[model samples]
Target: MGLGFGFKGRIVACAMSSLLATIAAPVWAAADIVIGQVAPLTGVIAGTGDEYVAGAHAYFAHVNAKGGVNGRKIRVVVKDDGYKPDQTLALTKEMIAQDNPVALFGFVGTANVLSLVKNKVLSDAGIALLAPYTGSLDLREPMNPNIFHIRASYTDETAKMVEHLHTIGIRKFAVMYQDDAFGKSGLAGAESALAKLGLKAVATGSYDRTKPEEVGAAIKAIEPASPEAIIMVSVNKASSAFIKQLRAAGSRAQLYSISVVNFKELLKNAGEEIVRGVGIAQVMPFPYTPATPVVREFQGLMQQYAPGKVISYASMESFVAAKVLVEALRRAGPEPTREKVLAALEAVRDYDVGGFKIGFGPNNRIGSRFVDITVIGRDGKLLK
Candidate 1:
């Protein structure tokens, strides 16, 4: 009887040990914080998407290598939406179903963000949406509680362009924009800024992205009006085409473009000689400027992660977005919940990360509103 009781006690001890192992396994496993991103990875706007993703990944890799955020590893899942609204919605839904990420980061286009906003997924999920590439007024105006924008709005860029144009004695202006929400938002901002100066656009032209070849005709139509400057509210590809057509047509008007026109791509498309003397409004400081601490750190990271590539405002914005998210996560403390993260972000005030200062409150979702004008010199450099 004593031998049988000892055998049963040993069996009960083994069962208890097995139960404890099962109970503690999950607790011992590494906690993961997933971040979802949707961008135009393989379509017309793929170049922009590439820059954004590169910057974001570089930041994430740097953070992960340094023990991650409060011991929780960050996993970034990027999906290609081809810069289309319907496709973006599908991709976003897939992210929610598969990853259920803590937040959405680096979504590329205005139309894509608009689609998500229309669907109300950000609010429903109570997930933080950060640093969407576009600066559409819709993102700022409606004040979506969960969505936070780190870049300057198109309105801010337009106002700065108009102010600089006025300084340069450019009263007569013609506008060329893509016939979409992003372009329309730019046009509206330009109109509003012009109104402030008691001026108006003398000639206006619009083109659909589907037919970029028609952009030359749009420029031709605007040129006949003989405005002193042409303000282009199109993306990089269309802007390049317009520049080529304008130069070929000998339209000698000064050209000013929104920040969407990638200066590097423009130089490639319409050679340095052709794109010389073009003016652009930049929301962030020049990425190559190693004078600022933030710029130096960004340059270092880019060298480490994405070597030999020119950094642009878009890339810097991506970096700043990552910095802001990391800072919010740090402030959220150990074992962070979604509510803690949101509260931490709301508590952020005058938070300076490198050169950019970000401030978000209960009433303010737009973080930065600063803008500067930079001109492309004859040597293919953006001169401030």
Candidate 2:
């Protein structure tokens, strides 16, 4: 079992530059709290995981610069899981035995988390998993005390989009989803939402998450339905490829995606022209819009620490996760422990991270239920 650090060293370096005894003294006097993250640093969904890790890094860096949480700086240790559940399971075990971090933070993928959960990895190790990237009902159902989620669930995102699409007079819905737990969760949500309105997807297709080339087969399934619009639940590459192929095949079906797809990466792969007017359900406030106070802080911190990084919803969601984690740490006080951090997180309620709010309690770990919908405009920006 071996371990590596991602954003911790830089945060400490930034903290030390102050040289003021108050800030510098903490480096020596305070205990450093280490947290582990398992994400896909490579593979098709790589961009989503990479961007989110950068966001968490940016926010943690900002907190460390301001003297950290209760004087103890946070160290985020990251390992690449390659977006594979098996890899996520392996890395998580290594993280527990090797790194022994206080908690598992910002882990990506529904299938990955489910693998960890199903095998009793976190519960067996007695460590909390905080702010997982994917929001599956599987994580929240039966209430696993060790897991805390910051963003809205796939249910929330899909339900909102399906309802919005229905409200806009588009009745015939088609779905193209990845063949995995994440995609199934989104599909379930879409079905539930549509059921509430006495509607259903006219056509649906599933593709393997690991194979972008397989998206062509799913498109073949969706095109024959001739639905008015299609709801997609996939990663950046597969979904981007799906949209490009669907367009090339002369289908005018409106494109809609769940929040898990990174629009920035989608734009890069599929281009603005193909993705223009594509609807996406988002769980975080748009980073480009400074109207939300949290967006301003996130953007400022990203610029300072992750220079030249594109402000993306993926990063913004992780920023929220990092901010909430720091707040929980601060509330846990100076001599923080795994139990204390979990207790503090549970005790959190109506805590404001700038304009947005996060809530948790003894019986609840659902941080926020906020979800929004946006469309990619012709100008290469998300429009509300």
Candidate 3:
């Protein structure tokens, strides 16, 4: 809750990732550029943060290996917030007040980011928050110059899901979401999407994000309506539990989720039997695909830097975010200031990073509109 040891304890080296004390060895130099992350490293969402940090560090390691990013090595200083918004606010301020990172990158959760924005912390400091890892529409609506998002909005995702399901003639939708900003964001998106199609959700359910294991009641709450499709806007633990319990309760509605739900964690929490045929929208392209240059490059980097770990959307999204951060820093020229970096980000437009394109102009922080759907195959892995 306070300045715990995990603050700045997470070390992402050029060669690899480490959690051990850096003082024990001669590693990072004065020339290395540091980025800060306030993430969940000690809660149910820990694996999500881990995968994201791994991806960002792995990409940075690749960049460092190739003569660094504009002759400066990249390092990430991470703090564990246990997915608590208050902890995120405190540690984020500490990260800025103490570490003096060039940028604040990859903070997870809608509420955490909302806390920062509500207090005007990042904007007040002139620090840019690149890709805070949530698809909340509130972040995108008012056009905060300090925030830049690389993924599709929650509206883009849920609308895509609803549109696809509607095209396939499956209406009668229900929603199960966390009782929080993140969940309500998806709920609003679904509502808008359904409204656009002249349809409405049959039933909806809510569960506490912190008490994710209490998903049985939420599942039972939606059973009576018997929707043909259940749109889920929650994280891995509760979403998987809902799916498991819904199936156990004999509700045969096909389950769908937004991109924020980590499919790997879902698979780990709910086995293949319960998760089969469940659809989830993805903002990032399939990481396993060889055709997409960015994904292929990400795969190669994961092989070299994170060999034993599995490739996931969280990591892949972080890798892309790292690439974007590096490019913007590069554009800021040598000896870049945070203000210069902000200016550089504002100028980005239709810039291609490998296969995908990310663009941001003045008054527009939404980078990409790409969204796709994937389903869990019978074998437990998500299929495109």
Best TM-score among the predictions, by candidate number: 1
lDDT tens per residue, model 2, 1-384: 346435887678667776666664645677678889999998877787888899999989888888888777888889998888999999899888987787779988899999998999988887888889887898888889999988898889888888888888989998888888888888898888889999988888989877865687888889988989898988888888899999999999988998887777778889999999899988888788799789999988999999977578888888988888888888878887788888888888998988989998888989889999989987787788
For model 3, how does the per-residue alpha-carbon lDDT over 195-276 read when each residue is reduced to its tens digit? Answer: 9999999898999988987887677678999999999998888888898888888999988999978776778888888888
Residue runs of model 1 more than 4 Å from their true location after superposition: 1-27, 308-310
TM-score of each: 0.92, 0.91, 0.91
Ten contiguous residues minimizing lDDT sum, candidate 1: 1-10
Residues forming the 10-long window of minimal summed lDDT in candidate 2? 1-10
Q: What is the lDDT of residue 129 in candidate 3?
A: 93
**lDDT by residue for model 1 over 165-260, one digit each (tens)?**
899788998889988889889999999999999999999998887665479668767978888888888888888889888878778888888887
TM-score for predicted model 1 compared with the true structure:
0.92
Q: Model 1 clash pairs?
A: none
Backbone clash pairs for candidate 3 read none
Q: With candidate 1 superimposed using the best TM-score fit, by how many Å does residue 316's alpha carbon deviate from the native?
A: 1.2
Clashing pairs in 2: none
lDDT of each: 0.84, 0.86, 0.88
* Residue 160, candidate 2: alpha-carbon lDDT: 87
User: CA lDDT of 366 in candidate 3?
Assistant: 90
The C-alpha local distance difference test score for the whole of candidate 2 amounts to: 0.86
